[model samples]
Target: MGVFRFESKYAAPTKEQRERYMRGECEEHMFGNDGEIVLVLYDEAAYLKDDLEGVRILFTGASDKRKVDDEVRRLLEEHGQKEQRPDEFESGKRR
Candidate 1:
């Protein structure tokens, strides 16, 4: 894990500045009377969601796609088997 420092001298960042920080580009300094330090792995979304717990942070999604064709096929087969049982479906008229 990357370690970051924080100090009290750093000024509050603007909206744009926080956005930049979300992109893993900006390193913010949390200032204190002792000294200034940089915050690593700083998530701006968490800060924005202040007081609102359980909030999700939106950002770029991963590009890695999983090959689920086989899994989907198996699931469909299982679903078909389940549907084959009369209890799985309601006995009603169909078009």
Candidate 2:
């Protein structure tokens, strides 16, 4: 398991920044006293519903892409918000 955090000394990461992390291109290293925690593995979905929580950038584990994609969809459905992508149909990522 890994701690997927959007860290910055200036301020909390923006939506685009979170997207970059999701692609596994950013977050080269970790530092102390970063900004707010958006996503996590053993996440706080208990209190903060997965739907109501911050932007879900990544879901790391042994789970494959299909499983993660399904989980993300489920969370968004429960959220009732069109914040994340895949707004209409397929994600067009070639799965």
Candidate 3:
């Protein structure tokens, strides 16, 4: 299994709060690999079912390890997000 990174302004249900989502009484949105949101509605059981709104299920894969930074930059560009300098000390600071 791959690590799925979630980035959304929307709030996520906590473990204790998941019951509402699991029961399909709440709505949630997840980001696709392409960075687009796939709207989903939860049932009383919160299990992703056929009733889940938006684009039903989306199959995704791991972000390219070598190209992840570049890809994120591209996405930011599309959204007019301000350019950020790469962390210059990150690699050197790691012990």
Write model 2 residue lDDT over 18-92, tens digit each, in one string.
444344322222211232222233321111113234433433445432254455455546544554455577666
Q: What is the C-alpha lDDT profile of model 3 across 1-95, one tens digit per residue?
A: 12123343333445654442334445554443443533433332221212212222221223322333344344446434322555345655655
Question: Using Cα atoms with residue i matched to residue i, what is each candidate's TM-score against the true structure?
Answer: 0.23, 0.25, 0.23
Give the per-residue lDDT digits (tens) of candidate 1, residues 13-43: 4566456545554443332222222222333
lDDT of 1 at 33: 27
Top model by TM-score, which number?
Answer: 2
Best by lDDT: 2
> Whole-model lDDT for model 2 versus the true structure?
0.36
Q: Record all residue pairs in model 2 with backbone atoms less than 3 Å apart, i.e. clashing.
A: none
Candidate number that wins on TM-score, 2 or 3: 2
C-alpha lDDT score of every prediction, in listed order? 0.32, 0.36, 0.35
Error of 3 at 37 (Å): 1.2
Which candidate do you rate higher for lDDT, 2 or 3? 2
Model 1 CA deviation exceeding 4 Å by range = 1-66, 88-95
The candidate with the higher lDDT, 1 or 3, is: 3
